[model samples]
Every structure is written in structure tokens, then in C-alpha cells.
Target: MAEGDPSYIDYEAFLDPDFSPSSFANTLVTSTNNATDTPLDLSTPLSRVLFDLQEIDTHIHALTTKSALPLLSHTQNQTAAADHILKESGTQVAAVTQGYERLQKEVVQKWEAADEARVAAENSLATVRLARAVSRCLTLGKQLESQVAEITGRSATGAATSVGVDGASPSAGRDGFRALERAAYTILSLREMFSAAAEDEEGYGLDRVKVIRTLRGEFVIPTENMIKSRAQQTINRFSLSSNSANSSNGQSSTSSGYKQARDARARLATAATTLYLLSPEPKSSTTAVDYKPELLLSTLQGYMHTAIMTSVNSLARALSQLPSMDRTLADISTRCQDIVALEASLKTLRPPPHPLLASTPTAETQAAASTNSNLLQPLLHALDTSSLPSYYWRSLASSLTSRVQEIVNRGGVSARTLRSNRDRLRIEIKECVLRASRVSATSLLAEKGRSGTDTVIVGNWEREAAVMVSSVVGPLGR
Candidate 1:
């Protein structure tokens, strides 16, 4: 078995690169970096991780076969006894004892079957994590590479410095370093799987526990950022599409005005598909959840910080061109802005410092400071009650609030696409978000940050962080 080789295993069999975890990394960083405009090194690490996972998955499958043996043997013993009893003249027997024995045997086989599976699933999750890690790494890697390439392209001679985004300097970008940290976390998650599997109970039917839950534990789902990023990629592709269209066919309508709604819809569809294909596969998520809506909400929140702000900014630039959808879109944009503002307000809103100053900041004081950092929950609740309808509601909601809304609902185009993806990414997104929400942010962030693949990228943070901070500080310096 060669390392990074796809020969023994099927990469496409487990996940589609077009829409799978593979898709996010394989396409994202490569495209972001490609001087050639195609996928390159992204697959190398993905293949390595996938290969690692395939090896582990095979082992887990073998363990499942092993765990079933005791149950099978017990069943056979009972069958034999029952047959003997039926042939000989019926006698009462210990079916309860036999069943208990079977259960005990299985439990004895794997002490924490569910827990072990949870661990393995967490480990297996690294498959996607690795992909995301590499994707971000590649993107940031390219960011550095572009610097080198730019320096050398014109100079065309002297050697450039060995330092890069991969370098461990705080100055390049406190933000850039943060991006590197995220990428590292994801890769580490992949690496951590190897050790996590080793840590499981001996001879335990952990595979049996997989049936109980889908790798139950905290996992981050990057739903919001993913969608926003995808939209960003999509928008870029469409800008090209329009250019190509104009070049080949000539502009059918002026770049300005509302009369071009028909052309606009066509453009949007083209952009959506282009975005779907070119869109980077999202990072693996660790958020846990029991159901769907909570997951979706969490995802939207995540994206609120990343591409949403950029997309809305693009949309604003595009209004003259999107005049047909202007009024409805403006309303939606305003609502989204409000959501962003509220989120900002929450981040800033904190209790005043107590009048009693201490020699050292107490544990209680630290806890209180930490509490100031997370106002997302209560603020979200307030918005849910007081706000205009969510965009998700446009399709999932029961009623339409306005006639102009007919543009979105007219043919159910967006709804159909959204529905098709219902089972694919969003569910996974939801699960991931829920799992993340369960964990302590400090621990979660720290854990992911340790991995070169799992650190945060500041350009992608929700825009309202500063706003939230400002609001929390208020008029007086408390």
C-alpha cells in the first residue's frame, strides 16, 4: 500500500469531490493559489488522510465482525437448547439468563462501545478535517507563495526568503498567523484520529455503538462560512461569466436598471451553478446537535461573519445591474444588516467592572470576563422574536409576506436547489454546529488552534465583532 495512493481504496466512493469534504479542500486552496487555474497539491494530503481513514475504517469493520461473534455464538447455543427441549418434551429454561449472558458478553467485549465509537467517529471526522486543514493551509500558503512569486516574477533572479505563511512569525499578520493556526488544527485533527483509535477499549464492540449515534460528540460545522465562501466564489465566477457573455454575444441590455430582471435571473442561476462547482469545500465541523433547524441557524450565524458581509457588499455594488430584484433585496439586505448589528451589540454589551478592585483578578472575575465574550445566544433569541423573517423562511416558511416576494417564489427554483441539498450538506452542517455549541469556546478554540489546520482566518470573521464590542462598552468607561 503506497502512501497517498488511491489504488487500493476508492476516494470517489466515500465522498464526491464535487460536493464532499474533499471538494472543499481539493478545490478551494488549489484554485485560490493556482497560477494555472486548476486543482493541484490539495489532493495529496487529502489522499493521505483518506488512505489513513480507509485503513482505520477497515480495522473498525474487522472489530465489528469480532464483536458479533459472541452474540452469534450465544444465539446458536440457545437455538440448540430450544431444539433439544422441543424434541424431548418441553421444560422451562433460563432464556433470561441466556439473553443476559449474550448482552454481558457483548458489553464485556467492548466496555464503552458507544464512547469508543464516539471517539472513532471523532477520529474519522478528521478525514474531512484534513481536507479543510489543507485547503486553508493551501490558501494561506498561496498567499505567501504569491508574495514569493511576485518578488521573483519581476526580479527573475535572486532567491527569495524561505519564510512563508508556514513560518512561525506573529508579525506577518496576526490575522495570517491565525489562518495558519486554523489550517494546522484541521491537520492535527486528522493526526489525532490515529491516536484516538489506539486509545479505545480492547476487544470492545465499539462498531456496534455506531448504530446508537453518528460519532456522537462535539464537532465544528462551518455552515455559515462555507455558504458565504461559496457565494464569494460563485460571485467571482459570474462576474467572469458576464464578461464572457458580453464578449461573445455583446450586451443585450444596459449594465444599469430594473428592466433586465429576466437577464438577471439567468445570470443568478448561472452564478449559482458556477459557485456550486467552483466553491471550496467547507471545513469539517465539530458542532453537535439532535435535529436540523438548530444546525442551520448555527451555520447561518457562522457565515454571518465571513462571506455574508462581503456578498452583501457585492450585492450593493450590483444593485444597478440587479434593479429588477432591488426592492425585495433591499429589504432583505436591511434585515441582514440589522442581524449583523445586533450580533455586534451583544459582543460589546458587558457588565461594568465591580467597584471592588482586587490585588489579582479572581477566578470569578475571569469567568465574568469570559461571559462578556459570548452574547450570541440571548441576542439570537431576541432577534428570533423581534426580527423580520429569515431568508431560510423564504422557502421553508408557510406564508409569503409580500407580492414582490413572488420573484423568489415564482418558479420555486431556489427552493428546489435548496431541497436537493437538504440531505447532503446542511444536515451535516447542522450536526456540526450543534456539537460545537456544546463545547467551551476557550477549549474548542485552543484545541483547534493547536492544529496548524484548525486556526481562524480573520478576513472571514463576522464583521460585527467590533460593533458588538463598542455597544457592550457603552457611553461611559465602566
Candidate 2:
């Protein structure tokens, strides 16, 4: 047989030589291992073997069917489909990862923005609180004014009952001084705080003008009025001294009117200086009159002028009844001391010039004329020279000088727009003083020194009055 032939291994004898014939006798089988063997009848031992062999064949056939050719052919296609799906899932996972990252960044930014907004809210709230505090200060200032009024009244009335009451119980006066000082200090602190807030032009919440007006109405005006009243009362007390005293000099030995007048003058100076400092500086031409400080200053100046005039008029009236000029001169000389004190008060009233008012070329000429207008000219011209004696002009000059000095001293520092107005006032008062002095001197010489002469005796009185006026004017321009 050829080696490659299907029947390469011929049927061979495989029956066991020792096998009993009976063992195979019952089996209906053919033993291919033994070519000489014949078909046999079925038996118990052979049947058992046949059954075990059949079970094994059945398992092999089942396994072969599961791994059939058709099923094997679809394996590649399944594997390819799985690969495509896995690739698609990978891409989706990457996209999801990127989206998650973006969301995380957005969340972080939102949190940061929220934090910033919270901080801004807090800053705004702080500013509002400061503004409220400033407003409350103004309210308290009003209350303080009322309390001061009551205190002043009580002090005035109490003064009559106790001669050395204030001296004995200095605590009351010291307490009053401390209270006034405390209130003033509080007002200044508030003003400084508000001014700092206003410096931040972008974030400033409070109205500048409103703050100024509040200070003026609640603080400055009340203080001015109180001082004015005190001065008047002091003068009134001095007037009573002459009636009560039995001194040979016809003046009170207990309290001289001259000394009292000096005291009153000092009080007025203190009031004027305080109010002037309390006033706000003007930034521009429009704000010059609009600013509370400016308005308050103007009001104070007018008040001081009126107050001084009242005192002067009162003194003049008191002395008018006297027969001798010597007694009147002595009294007038004492009042003149206030004029010297006026110089110090005037220095405090002046402010730095505003740049805006300096640059307005269009109104320059008109402004100059308006500013230069003399306030005293009309007052002097309108006076009834026929009714008033020549010596009356001397008293008038002395009073006018006090008013003029105040304006002149403040001229350099006041706003340009306001300066002209003050100058006008100063000029008027100064001119009026000059005119009155001239008239008084001419009248005195014509009536007294030149009585026998045909030509009017051009006496030394004109030179003396001129020298006095020149002395006051010298300090004014400087």
C-alpha cells in the first residue's frame, strides 16, 4: 500500500488472546482491530462499552455543531464592529472630559465675581454710613445751640444775684468753656472728615454745598449771635455802673466803661475770627456766593459791622450829654482800641484766591468797576451835615475805620469775584471816613482857630486827622 493511501493501516487483529469467547458472544459487534473476527451476538460487557462510546461521540458532535463553519465565518465581522464602537466611545469620553473642564472653569469665575461684588457692596455701605454720621453731627450741632442759649440766659440772670458767684464757683464757667470747645472740636472733626471724603471726586457721595450750609446754619450763625449778644450785655452793664457809682470822676470805680468796652471788643473779635475760620473756601466764581462758608462769612461781616456800630452809637449817645469834650475824648479813646484789635481779626478772615475767578476776562472790566465802588461815599454824602456838629465827623471816621480795616485785610485772600465787592465796601467806608474827617477838621478850624481871621484858619487839626487816617490806611494796603 502507498504511504499516502487512505487505507494505509490495514485492519489488524486486536482481539485479546486471553479473551473468553463468552464475553463477546452476547455482543452484536464487529471488531475491526481483528480482521479474522466475525460478527457476534450482544452481551452485557460489550453493551456497556458501546453505551460509553456513544455518549462520548454525542458530546463531540455537539461541540462540533457549536463551532460550525457558518458561525466561524461571522467572527471577523463581530470583532470589527466592536472595534468601531470602542473608538466612538473613546471620542465621546474625551468630549465629556473637555466639557467638564470648561464647566469647572466657569464655576470658578462665577465664584470670583461674586466675591468681588460682595466687596463692592461693603464699600458702598461704608460710604453711606459715613454720610449718615456727617448728617447726625449737623443735627447735634443744632441741639448744642439751643443748650447754649439756655446756659447764656441762666448765666446772665444768675450774675445779678451773686456778685462773686462766677469767681467763687469757677467750675461753671470752666464747664461752659469746655462744652463750647467740645462742640467746636466736634464740628471741625466732622468738617475734616467730610472734606476728605469729597477729595475723591469719583466716589464722593455727600453734597459739598449741603455740608457747608449745615455748618453755617447750625453752628456759625448761632455762635455769632451769641457773641454779639454777650458784647451788648457787657456794654449795658457798664452803662449801669455810671449811675450806681458815687466816684468824683463821675465814672464807676468798680468797673470802668472803657475797660468793659475793651472786653466787649475782644469778645466780638473772637466771634468774628471763629466764624471766618468756620467758613468754606470757594472753588469758583459761581460757588463764591453759593458756598455756605462764603454766605456765612458775609453774614458775619455784616453782623459785626452792625454790632460795632450799635456799640459806637450807644457810647456816642452816652457822652453826647456831657458839656466838656475832654470827658467824651477819654471815652472815645477807649473805644478806639477795638480798631487795633480789628487788625488781628481781619487776618483770620482772609482766604486764598480762587483760580476760576482770576481767569474770567469777559467780566474783568465790569467786575473791577463793581469791586472798586466805594461803600462809604453814599453813606457820608447822605449824612445830615447841617444837623450834626463838626466833632461828630471825628467819631464817624473812627467807626468807619474799623469797618474798612476788616475789608482791607481780607482783600488779598478772598475770591476775586468776591474781592471786588469787599473792596467796594472798603472804599466806600474809607472815603466816607476821609470826607467826614476833612469836614470835621475844616469846621473845627473855621469855628475855633480862625474866628478873627478873614481867611479860614487852615489849622493843624487837618494834618492830625490826615495823619491818623494815613496810619490806618498804611497797614491796609500792605
Candidate 3:
């Protein structure tokens, strides 16, 4: 059969060299034409079926040719356009794939670099913070050491420390104490620095020993030295006043002596508080067990003892010669003079070290206060007689009593209140003397002859007494 035509082939005739395909095709056409002319016989079923199939096949082939004609023309027209699109698409895909690969490699590298940079920056910050903490702590420690050395040198040489522009030491007087107070306050603030610096070490490793030891060596030890130096100076001043009083003629240094003594006592209190904080437990985690700085507490007690004794001794000697009622009154009047001096000294008293720098008191501190209180008993007993209500007129005594009462009423003493007290004392003394004169005159009159001419005698006696009193009161002119 031919490829384009599904017609029966005569292979035997084809094999014969005499039979050509064109001659055979003409014979087939002649037969079809002859059959068309004589085909009135549709009587047999098989012949009828074959003839219908032949007609159906011819109709189908014609319909297929008609439908495929337009499709062929359209394909011929679009062939060049389709080939161009395919070729361009393949090139574009190759280029896009290469570009995507490059982009992926670059993105991966950049992401890795950014991550590394972030880690490095974080590490640098941590290192900087650690270095800062170390530097700050060490620097503060060095300053503390310098202060300790300054204090020790001054104490050893008996030279006053140069504080700021004042050219004075805290040991000099009230102003010196003020400087010491400021120094102590600054030292106490170091703990806060430690806390703030410690917070940065979240995952970072830090040496706990270095931190605690630095605080101990730099801050705590030097503070202890300051306390001891202050206490020693207090004792020395008390000794100087005592010696001066002993060598002077009858006059007393009780006022200045007591003032210095009281100041020393206050300083000791601050020292005790500081010591307690520095050495809280027997084995402190923040400090060394063997280096608690409690050794000087005994020295502090000695200073306090000497100071109180010096004041008491000076007062006792001054009062020993209270020969008359007036002298006793005068001594009593002057008793609060020392107290007034003490109040003035207290006005300029330095505030205690801040609690952050202060620690719990040790057994030695408690003992110091206790032993001092015990030793003060004799001084208290000696002054008991002076405080009692006496039959003799307390002209100066009343004034001094009122001065003490005013101080007590005001809760604490100040410069202003002390001045007011001095003023009131002067006024009260005058009033007391006037009242005493009246009492004396009335007694004289009662003792004399009251029946006849007693008024005249009493008047004459009072006139003479007033003259003598005026002469005695002359030296104390307003």
C-alpha cells in the first residue's frame, strides 16, 4: 500500500517488471468507472457492506484533507517566530541561572561577615567595660593610700595637713573636721561604683578576689588609718590643754578642754561605726579575716579616757577653792561655760561617715563606750554636789542651770542657740544678784531691833552693803 493512500496493492504484479505503478493505477481507475456504469446489483449483503465501507472511507479522507489545509498554512507562517522565541529563552535562562548563583554566594558571604562583626563589637564592649572597672577601682584605691600616708606623716611630724586652700588639717579644729567629713563621704561612694560596674559582667568572667581586695586595700584600710589619726590627735590636744592648765595660775582651760574632748568623743563614734562596717563578721567575704583593722580601738579608748580625765581634773581643781557661797556660785556659773564651749565645738562637729561606708560595731567598740562610761562615774560623782539645790543663793548657779536647761529644751546646740544662752546667762546673773541683795537686806532687818529706829539702822546698813556690792560688781561692767 502507498503511505498516503490506504489502497490494496498488487505485490505479484508489482514484482513483475512489466507491470508499472502508473499502468496499475490507470487500470484501477478504469475498473472503478466501469463499476459505476453497471452497479445496479446491491442484492448480496457482503457486496453491499463492502461498497458502503468504500464510500465511507472516501468521504473521511476528503473531510481530513479539507480540515488540515488551514492548519498547514498557519504552521508554515509561525515556524520562524517559534524558533526565535525558543533560542532566546534558552540563552536568557542560562544567564539568569549564572546571575542567581553569583548573588547567592555574595549574600552568604556578607551575612557571615556581618555576624562576625557583630560578635567582635560585643566582645570589644565587654573588654572595655572590664578595663574601666579595673582602672576606676585601682585609681580610687591609690587615692585612699595617699590620704593615709598624708595623715600618718602629719601625725608623726606634728605638722598640720594642708586641706584645699585653707592650709589646715581636719585635726586643726572645726574646719579640718569638715574636710575629713567630705573625704569620708567620697570614700563611702565607692561601693556604688562597684555595683554599677559589676552589672556589665553578665556572661563575662570576672575575678571576685580582685574586686574585694581592691576595696579592702584602697578604701577600708585607709579609712581606718584616718580614724586612728583623728583619735590620736584628739588625745594629744587633750594632753596639751591639761598641761597648760596645770602650769597656769588658778585660771582654767575647762572650756576649751571640754570642747576638744567632746569633739574627740564624736570622732570616736564615727570611727567605731566605720570599723563595724569594715569588719562585720569574723570571716568576711568582702574583707580578709586577719586584717579587720580593729587593733586601734584600744588606742581610741585611751584618747577618750585622757580627754574626759583632763576636763574633769581641771574642773575639780577650779572648784576646790570654792571657799564661800559666792565662789561656789561663780564656779557653778562657769560650769556651763565649758558646756557652752562644747556646744560651739559641736556646732562645727563633722557628720559621721555614711552608712554605706560604715560597718557593724565589733566587741572592742562596745567595750570602749562601756569602759569610758564607767570611768566617767567619778567625774559625775564629783559634780553631784554642785547640781543639788543649796540653801545659799545660787546667783551664777541659776544662770548656768538655765543655760543648760535652754540647751536641753532646744534638743541640740548650735552657734545661734549658744549665743542666746550666753546672753540669757548674763541677764540671769544680774537678776539673781538683785534678788540676793533684797533677801540679804530683809534678813538684816529681821535680825536687828524692829521695835524702835530699826528701819533707819536697816536702811543705813543696806546703803553701806549696796556700796560694797557695787564696788565688787564694778569690774563686771556691761
- lDDT, each prediction: 0.36, 0.42, 0.43
Give per-residue CA lDDT, model 2, range 1-478, as digits (tens). Answer: 2224343211232245665545554332544233364653446446656775676566568667867776777887899999999999999999999998898789867888898999999888767765665566566556555445433533433442222455433433322323432343444554544444444432244445577466766665566456434433332222212211222132242224334333433443334334433455464444222223343345433434543466455433432222342343444432332232232233333332232223334565556534423322122233422212222434455664555455445555432323334444344334433333222111111222223322222213444345434433433553
Runs in model 2 lying further than 4 Å from the true structure? 1-185, 191-266, 284-478
Model 3 per-residue lDDT at 184: 49
Candidate 1 yields a Cα-based lDDT of 0.36
Ranking by lDDT: 3, 2, 1
TM-score of 1: 0.17
What lDDT would candidate 2 get against the real structure?
0.42
lDDT of 3 by residue, 59-140 (tens): 6687677778787878876997899999999999999999988987899778889989999998898777767766765676
Backbone clashes for every candidate come to: 39, 16, 5
Model 2 RMSD vs true structure? 26.0
Judging by TM-score, tell me the better candidate of 1 and 2. 2
| Predicted candidate 1 versus true structure: per-residue lDDT over 1-478, tens digit per residue | 3344345545564666455765655654665465585655666666667776878677668667767889799999999999998866533346667777888889855767778888899878755555544454344434434433332231223343344465433333222222222332332332233223333422123323332122212111232233234334432332122222222232232221112322332333332322222222233431111111232234334444333445333433322233333343433333343333333333443322211112245676566546433334433553353221232222211122122133224435443433344343233323322321222212111221233332122122122222222221221122
Q: Work out the TM-score per prediction.
A: 0.17, 0.34, 0.32
What's the lDDT for residue 326 in model 2?
Answer: 37
